[model samples]
Every structure is written in C-alpha cells, then in structure tokens.
Target: MKDPNKAKTERMMVKRTLKNLELNRMAACYVETKEDALKLVRQIIPDGVKTASGGSQTLVQCGIIDFLKEHTKYFDRYDKTLSPEGRKQNEREAYFADFYLTSANALTEHGEIYQVDGASNRISALAYGPDKVIIVAGINKIVPNLRAAVERVKRHAAPANAIRLASGRFCENTGVCISPCFDENDLMCHADCGDDTICCNTLIMKKQRIKDRITVIIVGEELGY
Candidate 1:
C-alpha cells in the first residue's frame, strides 16, 4: 500500500506539472499506473496508423511497444533480423510516422522535458518528426528544475541505461556520469564521458509553437530509470 501523505504530495506535484505543460502548449495528463498509461495511449492513437518509438524501458514496461506492434504499422528499429542499414532506414522513416512514443530521461516541474541520447534518433524525432509525440514517464522522473533534472539523469538515468545497454561506457562501470557535478549555469552537455559516450546529444524541450503536438503522461508509480 502507498503512504497516504506521499500519494497526496505526488498528486499535487502532478497537478502543477500538468498545468505548466499546458502553458507550454503541450498536453499533459496523470495516470495512477502503467496499465492506465497504456490505456490512455490507446485512446490517443488509433489503429492502423504508422507508429514509431524511441528505445525506452518505460514503454516496454507499459506494454506500449507490443500494443503498437499489434495495432499499428510500427517501425521496429530493434528488430534484430533487420540489417544495420535497414534499421537506419526505419529510424529515418520514423519522421513520417503518425505517432511517436518514448520516455523522457527527466521531466522538470517547470514543464520541461530533458532527454539525453547517444544515437540521437530519438531526440531528433522529438524535436521535429511525427504528427504526435507521446511521452510516458513515471512520477520519479519529475524533478524540481532543469538543474535537478540534469543531475537526476547523470546520477541515475545515464548510469542505469548504460548498464542496461552494456554500452561499455565509463558510467557503466562507475555507476555515475564521468562529470556528474554541475551548477545552474552549466551547459546541459557538461559531461566528459569520452568518445563513445551515449550522452552525445541533449535536448531540453520547453515551450512549443505546435500546440498539443506533444502529449506527456505521468504515471504515479516508480518506473524506468
């Protein structure tokens, strides 16, 4: 069972985040569980549409990946059967997809989405491609501000993802970013993970000119990195 006080505080935080997201021209909602998140996704995206996704454990946990596979023409970049070139083709083609689904590395209470990427396909798509971008993140992803969001990724998200991907990066062994410490004025890319670092690209999504183009669903449960 959840602690009542914690749950209440989380609810207030979610409410604040949603309000700010709307002000930024992004649609936002809160779900109590991963199942609810998946259900909400289904309602937003219809069947037979072309869909794609950034590699995300949150989507897998919510069964959104499998859902897309069954209901939509999903571009499966993770299909091992596909050659490297084929996978690249799919990544490029995802720009035209009707919907793109992914999870943010961190979300600021200020209503900003922060994502760090290695291949950068995901960040690129979030920035420009697809008719709609759906981000499903857990409450644990929420932070006080952009600085806290960056610290969360460096201390938690990046290291965990590095281990999961077996990227053989420095953070994979160290269990933290190469340069984890940063101040409010520091650049988001203030890291020294070397040439093979997955933190090659960083994106901080703030106000959007395209109203409602991006929808964020924040789950109450702890999920993903």
Candidate 2:
C-alpha cells in the first residue's frame, strides 16, 4: 500500500479543490463537525426560526430531531408523529417562517449546493420557499461538482437510501437504474422502484433566483452515510 500519510494528504487535496471551485462559483459556505453543526443549531434556534424538513434519517442519526425538540418552541415536525393540534401548529408556523434547517447532497467548494428528492419538497423548500435556508452536511457528502455529486449519490447514497426506505432484498442489491417496480404496486420489484430516477435529476441551487436564500454548514466529521 502507498504511504498512509500520502493517501490522507491526497484526500485533503480533493476536498480543498472542491471547496475552491464552490467558492469561485459563488456558493454560500460554512465548515463544521457534527458538534459544530449542533452548536450552530443551538445558536440559530435562540433567534427564533421555524423549520420544515423531509424525512432524513441522517439528521435523525445526527441527533438533530432531539436538538430541535428540546430547544425550539416552534418546529415543523412531520404530521405523522404529531397530535392534531401539533400538526396544525406546524403548518401555521411554516406559513411565515424566516429561517429553516435543511440537508443537501453535495457542497462544492466552488460554492454550489446540490440536492435530490423524490417528492421535490426538500429541494423546493431549499431552493425557493424559505426566506433563509441552512443546509447541514457532513464532510463525506462533499464532492468536486455536480457530476461528482450525482455519481456519489448513485454509487453510494442511492443504494443505501433505497434499502432504508424499503426493506428485504432491495436493500441488498446495488444498481443505479430505477427498478421495474418503480411503484410499489408493481409486483416484480420492491417498493424502492423509481427511486434512482428521482435522485438522477437533482435540483441545482446555482440555477435558482433565490440562490442567496441558501446557506451551507459543512461539518468536518464524516456524516450522512
């Protein structure tokens, strides 16, 4: 094997290159570790912000849900877990939110944010709707550019995410193409059909008019696998 130190140095160079590209391209940026992400969330919550989030298992793993539940007076929890009154409270708050916590697929050092969604709500909220959008990501999710971001999702995130979203054999298989059972009703495939298709055509935040509305928090620790 090559020198372990050299291998580490090369990886650092790749991250630095991607970061530079994002900067030159004018994307919003912040760097943090898992602890930093938590710290930042604590600070932002005190200023009083309402947030809406998709079902991101990674955020759950990061203890984000726990943080929000304990710290914020108002939050947009998924309707499934809330009481009817809490559900109404969430919707009412989302209507006039000035800031939000969101997640992204990749943060190019050149300053662009990339994300993919099945329902488009995550991308939509991050791109145009929220007055201020904060994207929290782990270092592992960083990539050189849009192309690399897609590949990262395909080779790694898609397969794992599909399994997490579904169950059984589908989780064991690693294929980039959308499954034939693109919908659950199709008996030939699992419930995860059509998932890859959704991830393939991601929303590029650089193309949005509300690009300024987005902010990024890049954690130094490996996160969101």
Candidate 3:
C-alpha cells in the first residue's frame, strides 16, 4: 500500500518525513507497526531481485531479512557453509545488489539520517554503491536536530550496541556514553576501545543528488539499538 492517510499522529509524521525526504531527493513512508513494515517491504521489492543487507536488528525483527534470504539472490554472508573466502566474496557482491537494506542509528527531524560504523561497509553501501538503498527505522530513532541526533547515537545507540556485539567499549561495561570526546566539540568517541570498537566511523545522510535512490520506512515501534 502507498502512504496511509489515517491516524492523526501517524499521518502527520508520515507527511513531514515524506516532505523532507522529497526535498532531500529520497522517498519515504510511515507504517503503523512492524507488521505493516514487513508488508510494505514486500510490495516495494519485486520478485527475484538480487538483494543484500547491512547488519540491522530492525530488518531482522520485521522478518524482512528472512524473507529476502528465502526469495531473492541475497548476499548471504552469514551462511556457515561458505568458506572464509566465500564470505568475503559475498560482501563484495553486496555492493552490486539491486537493493541494499539497512537501518539508521538516528533520524533527525531535519530529514538527515545518522549512523556510526565499525567496519564502514554499511556506511559505504548506504552513501553509494547499491542501485537502490532501503532503510527501515523506528520513530524512536528520531531526534530534533543533528546535534541531538549525534548525541542520541552515542548516549543510547552505541552503548547498547556495544554490549550486543561484545565490542568491549567503555559504554558496553558502563551502559552509558562516558566517552571523553563529549567535552570537545565532536560528539564522537576519542577514547580508544581497542580493535573491537564499533565507533570507528560516522555518517550523516542529508540531501542527495539522485532523487529516489534511497527510500526510508519509518515504523511506529522501537527497533534496533
């Protein structure tokens, strides 16, 4: 289904996000729930389209990843049958997939999506590489502006994600962003968290030259870190 026109709260946010996405040369919609999100993804993606996805808890929870793995030529990096070299090859192939799926760390009301990465493959594919980028995010990820967006990522997203991945960063043990960089102008973590750190890179997605190259689906429920 196209963007729904019911529910005052849902309707308003959908309109705002869509308008800003249009201004930024992207497409977007708001869904009422995780179930709606699953259905919307199916409608957007045609049958047999080669698909790939970055690591995203939102996609997993919505059953989007499972559906793609079963139906499309998905870049299956998680397949244990593949050798180490095969896993590397799959990652390479993901760059050329017809659709690349992922989730954002934070979304600013100003229409920018913010994300931090450890390996940066997700960030790279998000900015460019894939023919089409489909991002699924929850309304909980939304922030007032870029500064708040960055803070949101650090103060909440990072620490929780660190524990999940066992990245062993300061936040993982403490459950909050006590990174020293907060004192400085940058909101990024200047403290070293060893080789397993997840805060190595950051990306703030704003206006894009190619209209509709990216599409965002905002679900009502909270998902991902």
Candidate 4:
C-alpha cells in the first residue's frame, strides 16, 4: 500500500486498540519531529523526579540526556545491567517520576507496540513494571499490521540495533557482525555454548504487551539510524 494509505489505516487501527485499552492518546509535534519531541519531553517531565532508560541512542542523539540533567538529576539506567539495587531505585523513585522513556521498533495500526531489545530490563519495565511507559519511534517505524510490524523490526530495527550493540564487541572485531544472524560470539552469548542463555534477549512484544501503562510517541523524522 501507499505510505499515505498505510498511515491512514494505522491511525484508524491505533485508535480502536487504544480505546480498547482505555489509554489516553494525543498527537504532538514531537510525534513527528526531533525538536518537537524534545520539547514534548520537557513539557512532560516535571520537577523533582528521577528517570530511567534502556540505552536508546536516539534519545541521547536528540539531546534528551542534557535536557534531563538540566531539569533534574535523573539516573539513566540505559545500558547498565539491571541489579537488585537498581530495581529498588526504580520502585523508590516511581512515585515522583512522570514516565519511563523507551523506544520501539514498530507501532501496529491496531495499536500493538513492537520492541526488539538485547536485554530484558527495558522490556520488563515497559510491559507492566512501571507506572507509565513512553515510546519514542521514528516515522519509518509505523506499519499497517502486526505482521508487518514484526517484519519491520526483524529486517530493519533488529539488524541496526544488533550492529550497534556489537560495534565494540569481539564479534564485530572479527570477520562478521553478530546481529540477528547469531554469530558465534554475539554479546548475548555464543550460540554453540547454550540455548537458555540471556544471549537470546532480543525480544518481540505483542498482544497484552500493549496494555494501559504505555504511550506511543511517534517522531516525524528518521531516527535510530
């Protein structure tokens, strides 16, 4: 389908699904543009609240970290492994924090939120552990259906993210980059070593995962390159 048609259908489906979930949805300039997204984040994050992250580079590229530092002393737990102490911090600061920010690869027309993560903490918080979840996504991440959303994540977001995660690792240093291809020494783990490993952290979210705790923030510009 044409991009316009696909967008229209997605808007309709998103509307229906959000209504079913009883979530409050709104359209903002940041929903399409980087500058606007920053502005919106500023408006939403209030005084005296801590923030956590999932290591989304787009958020950093958009200067969100600087903005947060200027506004408040929020802790960014982006790339750090989640620990018992970190979970305590998340719970302790939960009341004061406005929302936890994360990124998603695709948003289905039916309002399904899709995220492919190399770790579980971000996905865990976005799913049900947090009071509010805000998802930042590029315009290209929007899709017509659940299946298309999954395909978009695997083909586009997953590969890019895999390479990004592997950039400084031994696998990237070797002959090939280990992304979805599952190289021998991918950061998650060596495929030959074990199957029940956290190396299988790239997660595909759907269905009940799109509950009331989440909000979708769509950006007009191309992000997460």
Among these predicted structures, which one has the highest lDDT? 1
Tens-digit per-residue lDDT, 1-225, candidate 3: 445553566557656766787788889888878899999999989879999888888999999989998888899876889998898788788899999999999887778889999878789888877979999998888776777777787778888888887856788888877663344455675655566678789898899988899999999888888
Q: Lowest summed-lDDT stretch of 10 residues in model 4? A: 21-30
The Cα local distance difference test for each model comes to 0.91, 0.59, 0.83, 0.58
What's the TM-score of every candidate structure? 0.96, 0.70, 0.89, 0.65
47-166, model 4: which lDDT tens digit per residue?
Answer: 667666665777876787677656765665542576868855654554345567767766665555666555466666665555666677776666776566555654566556646665
Error of 3 at 189 (Å): 2.7
After superposition, candidate 4 runs with Cα above 4 Å error: 1-30, 78-98, 167-212
lDDT, candidate 3, at 163: 85
* Alpha-carbon RMSD to native, per candidate: 1.4, 6.0, 3.8, 6.4
TM-score of candidate 1 versus the correct structure, residues matched by position: 0.96
Over 34-57, each residue of candidate 2 has an lDDT whose tens digit, in order, gives 766777766765634455665565
Error of 4 at 196 (Å): 11
- Rank list by lDDT: 1, 3, 2, 4
Tell me the number of clashing residue pairs for each predicted model: 0, 12, 0, 7
Better of 2 and 3 by lDDT: 3
Q: In candidate 2, what residue range of length 10 has the lowest lDDT sum?
A: 180-189
Quickly count the clashes in candidate 1: 0
- Number of the predicted model whose TM-score against the real structure is largest: 1
lDDT by residue (1-225, candidate 1, tens digit) is 989998798888999899999999999999999999999999989999999999999999999999999999999987999999999999999999999999999888889999999899999999999979999999999998988888898899999998998969888999988778666655444545567778888999999999999999999989899
